[model samples]
Target: MLRVLAVDDEKPLLEELLYLLRSDDRVLSAEGACDATGALRRITRALESGPDGADAIDVVFLDIHMAGLTGLDVARLLAGFAHPPLVVFVTAHEGFAVQAFDLKAVDYVLKPVRPERLAEAVRRASDHLGRSAAQRPPGAAGPPGPPAVPLAGPARHRPAPDTGAAPAAGSAAAAAADRAQDLIAVELGGVTRFVAIADIAYVEAQGDYARLHTDAASHLVRIPLSTLEERWAPRGFVRIHRRHLVALRRIDELRIDAGTTSVRIGAAELQVSRRHARQLRDLLMRQATG
Candidate 1:
């Protein structure tokens, strides 16, 4: 049985979500909150009281654009909870889909939420919880507690494109591969070879395709730079230009010559666009501080 909490500022939408969740046989109980604060309070009480607690919520159907604290804000807070509930963002807006995935949301359902879509989200959450329980350390009462605060770790998510099917939530290896493609398969002289993602210095876009640059050699693949950017950003790959994405760890130094900024990665110096310069600097600062 899955416990769910549906949070939204709109009373009618909140009610509709609660009703839909209750209709599902897998859902043990469903509750609603008018704001992030109320939702957080309920989650805190549940965690303090353990699984048998009255207000326990296994999954949260969060609304992205709430009145006070937005759904993202709420999720940021939950990331640190001792027992964080799986999140499933419900939104009419699609723009937050990438961020939702970055937060490791169980699912993202576009609003006016359909019963079928909501049910699918519940199934994924159940699968995830089951996997977590199975993988717990021997003799442990439960899975390890989450961070005391949301750590600024690298992103762990696949590309934002929908595949018409949810990924298998039971496989931890699958989740890891989604975040970082450890071995990139590329064709060299008509022979396919794998390159370690850690060895790649940077990626440069070549028309419809992108080329991965390593210390010794470069590999060109059919993947688009934008797609790689979306997938690898969490893995410390930052888009420094419209056509270039550089691995943060590979950057030797940032150089400013005649007011133009560029990053030196191995033997290559990739220029940074004005729009991405500040963001790159901030990311570097965060990485350094953390």
Candidate 2:
């Protein structure tokens, strides 16, 4: 039985979420808020009043954009606390999905929520929370205590080995031979394009679609940034900003202007928000040294 909290500025959306959550047997309890501040207050109160005098919120469904104190800000605040609830962002705007994942959100669901999508998110959140609990250090106190979420170190990009020559007939296939044939197919508009992961220069979030930029051209695909990041982050696609996820190999240079940092890749420049600048700088320095 997961105790969940939902926050959204839209009254109708909040109501709908609450109704859906209440109907789910897996949800032991649920709460709603119309803004980040309200949500924070409710969470604080719940923590203070609980039997153990600490919040037991297992999951949170957060809306990225609100009148004030964006969901990302709320997540940041929660990150400071021990054992923050698993976050599953419910957003109409797609630009912030990458940032949500960068903050280690459990999942991201789009607006005009579909029952199946919400269900899938809940399932994923359950799995994540279970694994997280199992990994907790021995003798650690239960929920609402400050527990650190492990952070992955700086991003590193490495190009795949070239396999131009064909293997001889009837000979054993090389290990590289197996990888050369693997690629993800992306469909955009009415055309399907085969994109070898190595060819992608970057991926940008645009509303409900993602713009996949390669050395040759860019294509718009109907996929969430969170989905793509989960698949590609281990393959060297790094989130440098909220809206931008760049192939570390594609970064041409890093520049600072007016106390803000930016990364240049090919002809386009992407801004790095202050919160992420230090991590990005460390990644860049590591790349230079290596």
lDDT of each model, Cα atoms only? 0.78, 0.74
lDDT of 1 by residue, 144-212 (tens): 343221112223447768868856767657778754567888998999998988778889999989999
Off by over 4 Å in 1: 142-290
Report residue 178 deviation for candidate 2 (angstroms): 78
lDDT over C-alpha atoms for residue 225 of model 2: 82
User: Distance from true position, residue 23, model 1, in Å?
Assistant: 0.6
All candidates: TM-score: 0.49, 0.48
Query: Judged by lDDT against the true structure, how good is candidate 1?
Result: 0.78
Please provide, for model 2 over 1-290, each residue's C-alpha lDDT reduced to its tens digit, 9 standing for 90 to 100.
78899999899999999888878878888889887656776666554454234456778999987643468867877776655678999999888888999999989999988888888888898888778768978767555543321122223568858888765764446555645555667776778767777778888999888898877888787888878887887777878777888877677656666677787777888888888788776665444323
Q: Give model 1 RMSD, 1 decimal.
A: 18.6
Clash number for candidate 2: 4
